[model samples]
Target chain A: MLYALMIYAEPGLDERIPQEEREGVTAEYQALLDDPRVVQAARLHPAEAATCVRVVDGRTLVSDGPFADTKEILGGLALFEADDLDEALEMAARIPAARMGGAVEVRPVVVQP
Target chain B: MLASLVGYLRDFDAAEEATQEAFTIAAERWETSGIPANPGAWLVTTARNRAIDRIRRDRTLTRKIPLLPEPEATMDEFDDPVIDTVIDHLGDTGIKDERLELIFTCCHPALPLEGQVALTLRALGGLSTADIARAFLVSEETMKRRLTRAKAKIKATGIPFAVPQADRLEQRLDAVLAVVYLIYNEGYRGRVDLGAEAIRLGQLLAVLMPEEPESRGLLALMLLHHARRRARFDGEDLVLLGDQDRTLWDLPQLEAGRAALEEAIARGGRGAYVVQAAIADLQTRDEIDWPQVAALYRRLVELTGSPVVELNRAAAVAETGDPAAALEVVDSLDLDGYLYYHSTRGELLRRLGRDDEAAAAYRRALDLATTTPERRFLTGRLEKL
Candidate 1:
């Protein structure tokens, strides 16, 4: 089955990490991406950089920030190929953001034939 | 039967439909042909055939066909064979392990705790969705949606229907045991028979995982508490354990609970459940061992770090003729919102000849109390003060 590990953390959290410990955190994430089960991985720009668009009465309403103002923003996402939800969760727990002041939401991807 | 069928079908909906169809057929056929010698085997064989036929008819279910065992065996071929052949092929030990698999899958940590409890009661306890809804005090539609969403997630997420591997077994089993205990506690507080349902689940778990002492310990704990259910109240008033009529207790069930606790001890079980079960057993004795009970509660507090256990330990300490120390322990705990904390503190204060303090504590307990019996008991204590 395919699962999406949606990583959520405070925006600019990477910038807050100590310079000495930053490389170790990056290495941990790199190790996770190296796993054969990880099909795709990407870290997003800060929520401040996001542009939100909404359709209001067929007129496009453009906004200057992420869709919702929240403490935690979408920090990263990983597409993983796992046998089951448990396997996907095992992969999610390895995400650096999950151990930090963040969370990972594991959702099953709908596979279209 | 549904458990084995689920193992065969690999789909909860399909297995449920197959089981229903099998029973409907049995109801009609049994009236004319008389009941079969082994009705369970007959139902299982019939359900498997129905499931196979249904899977064959539905094109979308073709993906699951590969997962089915003996896909080549046509429905006609299975008509007359001793139904036991299929059960034997499925590996029938004393108790089928498929139920354990079903339970583990239902109680999988990936699922929400509420879903796990409802699913465990539905799948393993053989409870109807309506009965589960009533027991949990939810609308039937809400419960139906809950079950539907849970089953859908299981299918979409590929939650496997098998016992957890050795590495994850302990944690997963604990989740399963916690769900059963939660059900038992809910039943204990309410008028519903969820307690019996929980005990039934505990018994099944104990049998399925004989090596896991916690399972037996949980069963023992529930049985011991359930044995005293009859004397727990006296006409809308809560009755303390010491004041309860002993004859009202279920003696045979209490004996069985003791036997289970001994088995757990023999297996070197020192987990939280085992320790709690040991404490419950000691409390039931005619000559109550207050010191031993306090010691067990201390161990429990270490194991769980729960203020409720500390409060219980304080209560036990007071019974050992040390009200002042027990009062100190109770005061240290941050349990102002807990009714039992206030009640226990009231009792300790009354014993120490602080009538005004005791009355205030009793009033606080009465304010926090939700049930009529609890409020009445607190009122009585205040009156005495």
Candidate 2:
């Protein structure tokens, strides 16, 4: 089964961490990408750099900030092929953001094309 | 038979439908041909064949599907007394005891609690959607949709149709035990059929998971309470435990319940249900031990941290010749909306010769009491005052 692990990082995590420590975190995340179980991985730009877009009543509405103004932002995402939810969760817990005052939300990928 | 069918089919909804169809056929055929020698084997074979037919007719043929192996005996041998032997020769997939797996899947955490209860009742209780809906006082259509959605969720999440691995077993078992006890509670409240069904489910769970002590504990708890079914009431009025005839209790069930509780204790079952069962075990004694009961209640309070258990502990403390201590415990708790809290306070106050205060507490209890029998009992106490 394939699971998409959506990593949410604490707001201002980059600023809070020392620059050298941030590189170590990035290297750890890079090491995860080399894992055979991981099919896809991406780290998004910070929430402040995000532009929200919505279609309301057939009108294209654009907003300056991310749609959800929460303490944690969508920092990264990784798709992995695992035997079950337990395996997927194991992989999710390995995400750098999960141990750095953030969380990983795992969702099973729909099997259908 | 349904469990085995689910094992072979690997699709809960499809396997259930096939089993239902087989039962319908058997019901019609058995009326004319008389009952089969080995009804279980006959049903298993028929359900298996039906499921195979379903897969063959399925629109999504692109997906790889494992074919269910046929039973060793043919349908023509149904009347033969030797059919049981033939069933025994059937391959591994023919009759796997996957009930525990099915139960865990039904009570999967991905599903809502209501869905878990409904699914357990429908699947394990052999209840129709309408019957489950009626039990829950909901419309048939609503229950049908809920069951459908629950099944879909199980499939969508790929909730494996097997017992969880050891690391996850306890967490999964908790959900399963909760559903079983929930059904028992619903049945315990005047729903005889539902209660009986819950007990049956508990027994099945205990049998399926012999290593799981909590399962046995739950079964013991339900059976012990159920043993007192006959003496629970007198005509239209509720009979207080102290006044009820002990001889009227089911001796066989009480014995079985005691043995189960003993097994739970021997197995080091310290879970909430096991603790609660131990308390129920103490209740079965001819000479009630208030101190022992109070000690068990204290353990129960620690395990659950539930205000209700603390309230029960207060009542138990009152029995140990400590009305004032019991009153203090009750006063420290905040359960004003709960009728039993006030009722216990009233009894304790009355014992201490505080009649006026006792009468006021009884009035509060009476106002909060929901059932007619409880109201009658409270009113009777007030009349004496």
Candidate 3:
């Protein structure tokens, strides 16, 4: 089964930190990506760069700064192919973001042919 | 019968249903032709035949449901001679090691504790979902869903159907033992059937895991406590330890309990269960050493770090003839609303001639006490005060 671990972290976390400290954190992410079980991983741009668009009736509406303002913003995501939820959670726990006052929400990916 | 079926058929739900079908056939056939010479073998053969038929049916359905895996392996595995050997051996001893695997899988740490308890009782204890629901005071539908979800999780996770390797055994053993003791303790509280089932499981665990001293220790602790079941009550009133009639205890069970405890101790290393069993064994004696009991409780507290153990240590301190010191120890601890703690405080206060404080403590204990005997005992103490 495949699980998508959605990483949520404090906004502006990447840019607010020192370059050396950020390198250490990036090293952990690199190690996670190197794991055999990880299918894909991507770090997102800061939430400040996010743009949300929606259609109301016939009109298209564009909004700035994520769909909703929140303390924790979507920072990254990893797609893991694991034997089970327990296996997936094991990988999720190893994500560096999980240890830095952030959280990883693991959801089963709906596989479609 | 079910274990052997599981050995042949990897799927638990299929194996369980096959065993059930085998029993139904036996029920009808035995009524007319009398009992078979080898009923176990008869059931195994019948269940195997049923499982094969089931696989054949599923194979045809696989065409309609493309998502369903082909059941050819189920039929192909039937050709293996190992299945027959396992059946023959299991028929002779009745206990199968596959059962140990099943139990461990049910109590796997990945699953929620509630799910573990529900699954263990259902799968190993042969309990109906309704029976387990009633035991836990939950709705039958809730228990059904719980069991279904747990079983589905096990299947999806592909949890291995084998005893854990030595490296993983110690960690896994703790969960298995906790589930077994949880069942036993629930049964110990007047659920005779559950208690007996727990003891049977404990005995099976001890026999299967002879190298693990904690298994033997658990069985020993349960047997010792169970031996005093008859003397634990007097016409719905809870009988305190001091008031229980020693003669009414089950002598044979006590002897077996002591022997099991001795075996655990003889194995050398002292685990929490072994220490608890040793303390229970000492309590069964005609004369107990209060200081020694206190020492054991202190060791238990160090090992478990449980507040309940500290409370028990206080009781042992009181038994050492210093109610004042015991009261001080009790005061230092925090076990609010625990009936026994309040009653213990009441007893110590009464001994010190502080009647008003003792009466207030007894009243609090009475309010918290749930069992009839406990309420009665507390009321009697309060009346005397």
Which candidate has the top score in DockQ? 1
Best candidate, TM-score-wise? 2
Give lDDT tens digits, candidate 2, residues B101-220.
667767877788888888777665556777677767688878877776776666556666667777777777888998889778767766667778788778887876788899999999
On a 0 to 100 scale, what is the lDDT of residue B141 in model 2?
76
What is the C-alpha lDDT profile of model 3 across A59-96, one tens digit per residue? 99998888768788898898898876656767888887
In model 1, the Cα lDDT at residue A103 comes to: 96
All candidates: DockQ: 0.34, 0.17, 0.17
Ranking of all candidate structures by their TM-score, best first: 2, 3, 1
lDDT of 3 at A26: 88
Residue-wise C-alpha lDDT for candidate 2, range A19-52, written one tens digit per residue: 9999998798889999999998888888889998
TM-score for candidate 2, please give it.
0.65
Candidates 1 and 2, the one with greater TM-score: 2
Per-residue accuracy of model 3 over B8-37 as CA lDDT, tens digit each: 998899999999999999999999999999
- Please list the residue runs of candidate 3 whose C-alpha ends up more than 4 Å from where it truly belongs after superposition: A1-109, B1-99, B114-166
